[model samples]
Target chain A: MIIRMAFTEFKLYLREPASVAATLGLPLLIVVSFGLLINPGTDTSSLVTYFPGMAIAFSLAILSLNLLPTILANYREKGILRRLSTTPVPPASLLLAQVAVSFAVALAMTLIVVVVGHFVIGFTVPAQLGGFLLAFVLGTLSLFTVGLVIAAIAPSGRAATGIGMLVFFLNMFAGGVFTPRETLPDFLNRIGDFLPLGATLTAMRDAWSGSFPQPLHLLVMATITVVFGLAAAGLFRWE
Target chain B: MAIIEVTNLHKRYRDHVAVHDVSLTVQRGEIFGILGPNGAGKTTTVECVEGLRAPDGGTVRVLGKDPRADRTHLRTKIGVQLQESQLPDRLRVGEALQLYSTFYPDPADWRRLLSDWGLEAKRDTPFGKLSGGQKQRLFIALALIGNPEIAVLDELTTGLDPQARRDTWQLVEEIRERGVTVLLVTHFMAEAERLCDRIAVIDAGRVVAVDTPSGLVSRVDAEQTVRFRPSAPLAEHLLTDLPEVSSVRRVGGQLVVSGTGNLLHAVTSVLARHQVVAADLRVEQADLDDAFVALTGRKLEESK
Candidate 1:
């Protein structure tokens, strides 16, 4: 029943063109933009080479920070959630449906980025294919879990969107989107590496370098997923 | 047997009491109307029974199960349409019906429901694109989609034109004819009088009167208000001399003769005897509106 509800929610989410564009189209557009600006052999290279890294990062961010919150907030604002409380549908089903929708979006984002990066940007994905896939999936879970927290706690739909933007920008900057964390100050590097975004970024960077994470990074990412997921579940309100 | 039993339901919001010691029983296969003015706690009482809101002090049993305690079972058997309910703006009418239908095990045929509610043309249209009457029709369609044993509708015809309102009223009758118990919450006196088998008039969070519509109306201290416009404003004694005239009051160049049956005939007889000509002579029958006003000491529109 829960899975059926989740599938129903995903179908509804996919019907919205704006949700589709934001989750699936925006990341591909970013990759195309990078493809235009970058020359692979140049010393002053563009961020096109970082497409695969940004793929996992962007997918996680969009699912957790962008898509899930808006959907949940809209449900709350329109009294859909309130009505559901009177029905047989479990409250957890709503949260699970949200995660399922984002996960589906992540799959689409990953495929787009991989195809675009390989052909247009002339970038080679990690040589350790198995290791990279494992790291990418774990990183997606971490980011998606963070979005669950936002969806649970946001007071309104507008507030959820605002907070999603704020969290996305902050995490993107500090999680080594522009520059690698190694070149930063030692304290900042230490803090960034432990953060959920920072940890996912490290996993993605390692995957891009054709090496698996040293187990501790994956552990930290897993811990972030569990902690935020629990917090979101505990604080969630059907009304 | 009663399909729904609400006993002394007391709901308070902050310092104000919303439903105060209100109790009513609705039997199966009957249309029971809950009529009240705005701010009269009609919605609160119904929502409590539907398990949407918990009553501070009361017991609500739908199908012999406590509403708040046995919510899942209660929900399966009961259907509800809230007063200010809203669906997603981009949700299509058919989609809303389908989504709600999924919650119930045995739902009505979607095509038949759309045609019954006159929403077939707007099935593919988004909810926000619908006109007010169309939206209301869609709501009614969604409410009946679930093949519920008991359905509660709050302000069913509010915001609808006269024609649309009559259509909805007829739909309510059709629903009852299918053996589904209905609890209609409304403020319109004529609607209650026309559609309800019995009515419970609420005021100030209390059940003021509960009976058949005409029973309550006849019980109130109301007399027929006989109104007539005379060509010449003279001798108030003309109407006052009538045998059945209770009181004569001049309201804006019109003589209002308040009395019981034969008051009109007596007034006309008196006027004819004196050869007085009256224009636009009219007799206003005492109805639920007058009873409501007389019982509450305030008009329905003025209560809130």
Candidate 2:
């Protein structure tokens, strides 16, 4: 039943243009544009190499902050969550299904960026495949857990989207979506390492460049996953 | 046997009391109505029975199980059509039915139920696009999709057209014939009189009377009141002394005569004998409507 519900939810997602734009179009456009257009300019890094990480991190921001929270909060505002509570299928199952869908879309979007970066522009695959996978999964859990908290607290569909956008812009800047962390001031770079999107980009990029992520970044990811996951689950109002 | 039993149920919201000591029983295979004006706590009481809300001071049992504690079990057996219910804007009628049907262990085929409710032609329509009558019929179909042993339909025909209302009543009868008990909540006296096997008339959060339609009608005080302005001044006792006149009062030049059994006939004959011409004489039967007023101490319109 949970799987069926998730599949139904996904089918509905296909009909939403804004969701498609945020989850699919934005990330793919970044990867393709950076890989083909811009020059790396000296000994720093190539656009093809640096952009896969940024594009994947950007996809995470869009899915977790924009897509997931808006959809879940809208469902609550619409009484869909309350209606599901009366059934044998627990309401948690519905939340889990939604989270699962969000994660799947984010992962698929990242994979598209990775695939396009790899074959289209002669971009190298992440050298530490296992480390890359671990970072990606943990980062998603942490980010989407925060998304759940936003969904839990937002009162209406419009309020949820507004909050989601607020968080997205704030975190995207921290994640170096517009500016590379290497060029940032020392204190700002240090701050970026602690933020969710920043931690995700740093960890994934490190894994892609042939090493495990920093222990602190991994810890940050795990702590947010556990803490925010529990908080959102506890605070969620079915109505 | 009573499939539903509510005992001394009391529910309050903040300082305002919604259900004040409401107790009613619904027998199996009967159309039971909780008839009352708007905000009379009909919805509150039934919501408790549906396990959607908990009573503040009493217990409600559905199918011999406590509604609150046994909600998971009760949900499968009871269908509820709440007053302000709505579906997701884009959900198609067929898709909504399929999703709900998946919740039950043995759901009726939604295809057949859709046709039964005259909604087969609207299977592909989105809920937000359906007309008021179509939306209502779709909701009825959804409620019966699980083939519940009992269905709670609150204010089911509030926004429906007349033809739709009559059609829905027929559908309720058909559902009853299939042996599913129904709990109907409404304010329409005629609907209650025609459809309910028994009704509990609620007022000010209390069940004022519980009886069959005719039994309630019989409970009405059979005094018919005649109000008119007399053409000439006459002694008030001339109208009050008659055997049929229960009482006579004069207010602002209009004579009010109230009595049981032919008060109008008796009062008019006296006016003629005395040569007291009456102006603007109006006579009306004080039937079940008056009974509601008598019990509640307020006209139904005023109460609403």
lDDT of each: 0.79, 0.84
Model 2 DockQ vs. reference: 0.48
Candidate fnat values, all: 0.47, 0.37
Pairs of residues at least 3 apart in sequence or in different chains that clash in candidate 2: none
B156 Cα displacement, candidate 1 (Å):
3.0
Q: Which candidate is the best by lDDT?
A: 2
What is the lDDT, from 0 to 100, of the residue B227 in candidate 2? Answer: 92
Q: Name the best candidate (by TM-score).
A: 1
lDDT of model 2 at residue B138? Answer: 84
DockQ of each: 0.53, 0.48
TM-score, prediction 2:
0.86
- True-contact fraction in model 1 equals 0.47
Top model by DockQ, which number? 1
Q: Write the per-residue lDDT of candidate 2 for residues B78-136, one digit (tens) a residue.
A: 88787766776777898888888888888999889988888888898888899887887
